[model samples]
Target chain A: MATAADITHIACVVYPGYDALDLAGALEPLTMLSSNVPFQFYVVGPSLEPVTTKVNASVVKTVSPSFGQSIAPTHTYDNPPEKIDFLIIPGGMMFLDPIERQQPTIDFVKKTYPKVKYVLSVCTGSVILAQAGILDGKRATSNKACWAWVMENCPNVNWVAKARWVVDGNVWTTSGVAAGMDGMFAWITQIYGEAAATVAANVIEYDRHTDASWDPFSDAWRTTDPDHGKSVQPKFTE
Target chain B: MATAADITHIACVVYPGYDALDLAGALEPLTMLSSNVPFQFYVVGPSLEPVTTKVNASVVKTVSPSFGQSIAPTHTYDNPPEKIDFLIIPGGMMFLDPIERQQPTIDFVKKTYPKVKYVLSVCTGSVILAQAGILDGKRATSNKACWAWVMENCPNVNWVAKARWVVDGNVWTTSGVAAGMDGMFAWITQIYGEAAATVAANVIEYDRHTDASWDPFSDAWRTTDPDHGKSVQPKFTE
Candidate 1:
């Protein structure tokens, strides 16, 4: 059974080189849930200005719109909803502007993590979380293409090598670009029950990756560098 | 091999209640392909103003951001590029503002279809193409959740019941929201090469649904209304 009253305001953080696609998968399911659940989500950036998003980590991170899609933000980190039940952070910044250059957004995540009911990181988004000292001891997963880089950068965090997504208490982390959808659905199933998740997935014709351990990218792409967008693809046995 | 000069400019149309999610799946592969292929995609609208996007057609079309995500457009129909190599139309208008009310966009599609090298429609975007008199006597597919309504409205189109996507010459039409990704990848394979498509899919960690006729949503969701976002889900056994 799902209770709408407890968790209502959801804030999705958008940043330079943010992968809007990572959030889209979760948004589709959440949007359907909002109908009956009354939960509302908004895009939040460092400022209210428009931000261009990218996910092709292999390519050079150019500010040009030709590289990605531009999105408008309704809320900023300095001025967000009074109560945020869920906070979602997407990856791409690490590949573009490195963790050290992303101080403001990182600081915001650190400060707000304690207040939010739950937090989710997609791909290298977990690296930002790890930098913020949030996933210090938590078992999390990240983009497999840059497995060594992520592990090397975050030594304190227990990075799971094989997982479509990981759930360690209130924190949820996913692998690569598309795995965020599987994680979000799994999170939704846990919070709103299996029925709600099923309906959300079916409505969008999304084949939900039910098993969390159903990940082969970590093993297959362990040696592959994130710079090589051209690689052999791994399939999920649905 | 995909030549860099052939089809370079792609225009993605975004409208009221447009599903950015549908485009996200397509863009991921296309973005990767753009590296060497030189094909660039841009978001376009009826006007320069920001447009809110939605895919949960079950909900009422609200202009408010609470109901959907807002995306900024780089170009408009009245003033578009000198040449558009590929035209990508996304669905959501048919579910929100009816085709008759979407005169500007519908007219744009009708006028641009013949000029472009190739045209692609995602989900109910096919319905828009059908409304523009482009799908007449052509094989196509649409959102299975609203199959009856689409069929009733567009009687001339040869709608396939069990197809992930349908390609008739230069025009490609997909099944539902997420099916567009599968279709776009297939289209990529056809235009570029199997190797390029495979790399793009793998880079994004997207499991490519290769079969053209591997569509179960059409059969399973024949009776489900678009309004009913909750229903039984269909899956593809990998």
Candidate 2:
């Protein structure tokens, strides 16, 4: 059993229009991990200001060197510290913009990945990685919603589908918001062993269904139908 | 089906030691709601400044305006111009402290309850409501882990057990963090009807068991304990 102190550094990226769950799902386990282990987490953004979520409820606070603020495991902290041991990128609506324009985020990712062994992404975060040329030929997945967009636009990448997670050596990616937890669990399992990961998932009552090694690199990726027309509320309510 | 503009106003409270799920769970449904419907959602704290979550996530870019920020929801640009149509008080680690201070939250709840038709609380947020004297002798439930605390500290409340959600008259409360989704679903069910709520819940893939009208005052609440910690996980390392 690992105590909370084992997780010393984790850095998360936040940008405007970020999906709340992608970040939250990745965090739930970490918060539990912190209770049993001692670690420092950071929410790094472009500026030392608040980044509004897509839903507008939760905000990711910036952590500047001069202004110190304390946010609990389940909350967002102000500007995070610069150095980190593990870095995670949770996707949102604006995840795939050209990295050239998103200099701050790309610079942060590029600078941190060489040092951090466990680098991860959720949903379209893989798109950002793709733009960064990090997953140029590696297998990965994003928000299944962006399946077509990624396949057509980012040809250098081998996009996986139906797979909850895609791991090629050290780099990892998840399918969507909910799947981020599964991906992170897999990462935790790799480092701490299965028992610890299972215990962590059990504590949060999360059920890991999709297989970790199942890569969707074939027809399986194309055969699935999109989750469109799922909204029941009439488009034009009478 | 709903456009971003369909929502007239939405506000989620931020305070110290607030439960992440209590906020995220409720926001999830509303997030989905916004995707389908047009609406404006805002995160408002007791003050206009940034409020940190219990999990150390800071919600930033917030304007901490007072109730007097605007007399009419239509007039206010920072927050709801008039009475908030939908308001959620997320359960946080800092519930009793606010009550003891008789801070703005207490006055806000008491003064606004008469106008706000739907007043929602997730997990221990109900404790805040109870402390505000709104749930006095009223059947409600807090986080199952904190049931004893709620009962012992807030004697005016009629604490219920073995129930995931409890609703009496206009007030709604949930058992724990995740159960906040159930409360939101039920609330959506009332506003849009079961067909809409059912469709919305299915879209989000929420595994909710209880329904509205499963009042905490009834014996049905005593049938089983969902939080008995029966959570299990895979032990295999492969």
Candidate 3:
């Protein structure tokens, strides 16, 4: 029976080509703690219409790029919550989409960051934060598969290539899609308490990569001169 | 340019209180292969309206039970796809939800299972399959937190207690939410070949639990007599 004031409004910015797992993985832990903490989660997009998650490629002759999931946004950029305590940003094939199509979300991130108590980004989502100048000097990370492109796009940002997730002040940035789950769990432990984080992880039966500095994929992917979608190399034999 | 015949129609059943991670974790890998396979994903519910993902608790005075995420169903049980190659069933608080509210989905599963080339159940999703009689005399696994309740409800099915995921013929059942990711990757490896799965896992930066029998959470939760939502035990320190 908590009032609206007691609720921590956590909003996630989404758009077409945003990764579904990146958004779902990070937010899943927060939803687990909703009993004690009235975490009212909101998915904000450019509009109220359903936005497609990232697809590997366009379907032949289809009017729209069909994805595994289409997430419905509760709030539009024009109608976000009064205040967002925690802001999550997930990246996907956003780089491929025209910058004009991405500008609204980038603007929203910049506008929302100052008011947000904590900010987190998953995968190439740090690129959006970087584009918004939030990661200008902050330590962050992104998907190693698109490492060069993320770096090339956001030159002002300080990117860490070898960490699973990086926490600097109130901002947390995870390496890639599934790594967001680990980062969110870590955030839950720090913010909600250790017990809450433990429960969240255990309920999902998630075997987390506990060591932040020990990211193997970063090492595995770096062995080759990376291409756009060249995700794994021969070194990933394990 | 894949024709209609070249596509593999994957249909996921979503109802009220379905786990977001359970659905997302299992489907992300399949979406990664959309380029080569044209794996079209279809979310089917009782109706065309939006379906809420599982929430930890209800908000006071709210008309509708709000969750972190809501999935929009492209198809309904009344109007399903002509053919479905893969059928994914994800679980959450469906146990608490009324059987009548769940009956439609259970009925849909029973009707669709025979035609589906491959069937997957994540977490307590096995319970639905069990309810639908699809798991009759077949070996399966489910979320360890609700082990007793699931076992009691589905006495006929041979429930495996120590598997991250179990595969018997064309049917697959995962231990819990995140465990579905491992199960899906394994399915991809077996069905699509090893190279595709390797790329999918690496791209998401998911370090998989390769061994099917290597489930630590099963042992972690088994230590305590399971409560409804008793997710983790003290032995989960690692």
RMSD per prediction, one decimal? 5.3, 9.3, 5.0
lDDT of 2: 0.58
Residue-level lDDT tens digits of model 2 in B94-192:
423444543455556666667655678987788778877899878887765444456667888877765667878778887666567777887776666
Between the candidate structures 1 and 2, which one is better when assessed by TM-score? 1
Candidate 3 residue pairs that clash: none
> Alpha-carbon error at B229 in model 3, in Å?
12
**Per-prediction TM-score:** 0.89, 0.72, 0.89
Task: Give the alpha carbon lDDT tens digit for every residue of B175-225 in model 1.
Answer: 887888899999888887798787666556677689998876665675334
* Model 2 chain A weakest 10-residue run by lDDT: A60-69
Write the number of the candidate with greater lDDT, choosing between 1 and 3: 3
User: Given the true complex, what DockQ would model 2 score?
Assistant: 0.11
The DockQ-based order of candidates, best leading, equals 3, 1, 2
Using alpha carbons, what is the TM-score of model 2? 0.72
Give the 10-residue window scoring lowest on summed lDDT in candidate 3 chain B: B55-64
Model 1 chain A: weakest 10-residue lDDT segment is A229-238
What lDDT tens digits, residue by residue, belong to model 1 across residues A1-238?
2244568888888877777678776677777676576667778888887777854354453323475777788888899777888889888636544567667778889988999888998888898899999999999988876676787789999888888899887899999888888888998888888988876676577777899998767556753345433452222110
Better of 1 and 3 by DockQ: 3
Model 3 interface CAPRI class: acceptable
Give the Å error, residue B152, model 2. Answer: 2.0
Count of clashes, each model: 0, 46, 0
- DockQ scores of all models, one per candidate: 0.35, 0.11, 0.41
